[model samples]
Target: MRHRVGPRHARRPAPTLLRGIYLPRSMDAGAHAMTTFGIPLLVLATTNSAVLTGVAFALEWVPRLAAFALAGAMVDRYGASPVFRTASVLRALTVVAAALALPYSDGVGATVTVMLLAASTGVLSEFSYIAAETAGGAASRAAGSRAHRVQSVLLGIDQVGTLAGPALAGLLLERYGATGMLTVIAGFSLLAGLLAPRQRDGRAAGLPEPVMKGLRTGWSTMRSLPTLCWLVVGLTLSNLAVGLLQAAAPVIVIQHMGRSSADVGMIWSVAAVATLVAVALWRRAIDRYGLWPVGAVAAAIAATTCLAVTLTHTYTTYLVLIAVLMAAEGGMTVMLRTLRSHLIPASAFGSTLALSALILLAPFPVAGVLIAVTPPALLVHVMTGCAVLQAVGLAVTFARLRAAPGLRTALA
Candidate 1:
């Protein structure tokens, strides 16, 4: 497909690698590192219970099922930049509060309270992210490619931070305690907040209509597009598998394999590094075969690799399988994101993209709960089976869409 700017807006100069791209990439790396690493370690160190850890994870994701629609509406109404900046500041403050509250929580109630607050802030930050990317025109195949490149680089950096954050958290916990580690997280969050500038494009100004109206419009557009809807379905099932695996893997590794928390972190770090390499190499793959085929292949690879994890009896084999799983997930994620951008319209960008999250991420809580209750072996089997089904479903849907004359015309 050819990439072209529409006549409705005059074409601006092509974005530079330095100014237009690298700045947001840097911001994402810092923000993701602080949240992904800090939140889990803080809970693990403070609460120190698997049940509570599961609760914390649930609190973080459960509300996104509902709130994302409204957040998307707000983005469409107010524009993305202001909301993005405001959410970042709020997230930074929330991190600071959780840091402060870490020492005071002696039991489940206090820990739950602190966790809920942190989780809520994370949702807000996520909403802002969806809005910003959508408003930046990251949905078009051409625009999406640029966004994917930025994400690839940022995620590669985030892998480094993932390795660093847990190790740093462990050391800080040993030295200055949980409070010291949290303080460092807060500092990093505040710095990320400070770096956010107003929208580089003028899309952040005046609303075109009421928030409700915009949402309806976006919904109508999405329903009219079968490929996009099926894509959301595929993504939702994929996320369910991921959530189950994440919740179950630690228990399996620790209980079955007799490993320590440090071992879990190390295994995850190996996966992260593998993901970084896969994402770096994925651009070439995308450039060669296009996003759809690459995404389907990646999904199949992910399902098989995750299933292989359940079969491994040795640590070295387990680590290798996990790394392969992470690499496949990383590569698939890049393609899925780019595909979402290509399918959605510019005007309804945030709300439309938010729907993808609403569908995919909303089920995570249930998945986590199932993991907490089910046997590890059974859970692994279920997760792998679901992943295989999702991969097959996505492949079939893509084939059907590709064969449809109407879709071909619309996409053309």
Candidate 2:
């Protein structure tokens, strides 16, 4: 009886801890996705301007990038649970406030209000995300040899949220309106806040340092890892094409293709399924072929699909190409996560992760600006140029990665 009881008690913490993190993270991720997709669509719906939609997209990503370092520092000082819950609650309240104020706002005032909401929520979402990531990192570190398995589960949960949020947001926006959509998003945020688990010690390692200091540590860490640097460069280039397409999606579907918001959401929802399948395959493929070979294939597929997507005029072709492109993106993402878990030392993991995220996210605002300035008809040409660059860049990067000694030793 004592032996059985002791063994059962020892096994209980892992599943319970995972649930405490995974459940709230799922809710938080879904709310974040809804806000991301919904806000740009909202801007388009309200202003009937592609430029404003682009601006809204920039507003969302820029602040999110800016907040990463600070959020990492805060999570280190205050612990993950408190920071996550606070950010979640703040996001919910902010969304609710925006929903209430939108109806009372005048023409320009309404636009300004929405823009403010986008920026604020973007910052808050980053805070919650970083905290959640920190918690997950702690759990992974605890798992020791099974860290990759834990990360795979977390990635799958993120994909599930991505699957549900955009389609639901589009439907609600089409049927009900911005207010209804915002309310639902707020509910999810509130749930995330309520579901946060208490940290065991309620604090992290050291006293909080400046964001710049964190960046310096992260930057130094990146320099030590040449493979990670090259991969970042390739991913950054790929993201430019991906980001541009995402920013221009509403305009392309609704204005150019004469489709509805639901169609816009459907594109992403379907693509997410392909991504999920790709992620699953990536897990198995990595074991048989190793990282470099699998990653090279993914990069090739992504590049080819992006190039093909530029020539697509029909909605069906566009959707299919985007799905394939996203599938490739998903595979590459798994490779990156696996590499990150293995390469980045546990001591600097949070700051380095935040830094890497910031670098990757740098392309989104640039894509937003391109969308704002470029003619909608010529956006395809821009995509073609970006796709060509991505292909070349990824090809070169992977060639180096295949030859890199550091990566070879790490894999060994």
Candidate 3:
């Protein structure tokens, strides 16, 4: 059933190439962007409620958080690439199921069921996402001096997807409604699934450890590194602030600004451009100026931009400021990701990154809860306080990290 190639004919190593498995992973991210952005609009359209929209947004993340430990264990025990393939198929199936349920989405019960089902898909998608990212990190490392450059390319691909996906979703939802848009998302998921298994990372091998054994190894790895542990804590706090933007941005853009879903699309499209520019400049800036200095400056910029969000009620200001704020966040994201790649051993990449991600993202739902309860007028002030807190925290933490004896040698 199988044909063997002669010595004269050999296949190129796609996994060692610049694009590699990261390309499909980026496409999958786009599918994620589509569903995540579409969910709030879909819920708001059906229920005519901002609170429900926030709840729907929160649902997407909750199950993913719940599944992180297991997802990591699975990826580590069985290999990241295969886990990614399985997750992609599951994502495609769920997207199809959710698409089929669209007609009944008008009722509260139906909407709730659909939202929860979407969350289940999110759980699987997160597994695939982590696997892809871990593989991407490996590919970039293999690329040598151009590692950051290759990573920038990958990040650009992801941003392109993130940018186009929501806008396309918005356009599709407006033109054809939820069913048509969901169909598109399902197609993306399916395509990602099909493409994933073609590329294999020689580096993504599984340990012989059982799930709990793997988890304990990852935990030990995380705890043994003081700076990495600090990074997880600091980044998690930073995400608490980021959670506000994620949960409330849609409400602000649509409900408060009196804008359409198309406006949300435009906002992120601009942000995507900003993200590309930021990623391009960030590594070079870090090389010249040092990571701590550049990160501090980025943190200051992000803090200033976020706090500025409270200064005006204008839709244009919110769009521009949020886009700029996200740009700064994008740079910081790459910086942190680089650190993770450098710090975590390849054997523990899946599990450690999973635990780290769980810690970082848990605040999103909390932000959703706050958005539901906090008065709209006071929301801006709360976000401003969070931004200020994050900025100050970043400054203090980075300073301490740099000053710590042996930290530089260890990182080196």
| Candidate 3 residue pairs in backbone clash | none
Model 3 Cα RMSD, 1 decimal: 3.4
- Give the range of the ten consecutive residues with the poorest summed lDDT in model 1: 403-412
Q: Between 2 and 3, whose TM-score is larger? A: 2
Runs of candidate 3 exceeding 4 Å displacement: 1-19, 144-146, 199-214, 404-412
List runs of model 1 lying over 4 Å from the truth: 1-21, 135-176, 199-215, 375-378, 401-412
Q: Which candidate number has the best TM-score?
A: 2
Writing each residue's lDDT as its tens digit, candidate 3 over 1-412 gives: 9776754324654354434566577768888888767777767767778787778777878888877877777776666677787788888788778778777655766677667765877688788878777777777666654455566677777888878887888888888887888888888888787777554443345563465665677788899777777766766777878778877877888888899887887777788888878877876776565556666667778777877876768888877897888788776676667667667888788888888888888887788778877888888888877888777776666776776443232121
lDDT comparing candidate 3 with the true structure: 0.74
Against the true structure, candidate 3 reaches a TM-score of 0.90
Q: What is the C-alpha lDDT of each candidate?
A: 0.63, 0.85, 0.74
How does candidate 1 score on lDDT?
0.63
Model 2 segments more than 4 A misplaced: 1-17, 200-207, 405-412
Better structure of 1 and 3 per lDDT: 3
RMSD, one per candidate, in order: 6.6, 3.6, 3.4
Question: Would you list the clashing residue pairs of candidate 2?
Answer: none
lDDT of 2: 0.85
Which model is ahead, 1 or 3, in terms of TM-score? 3
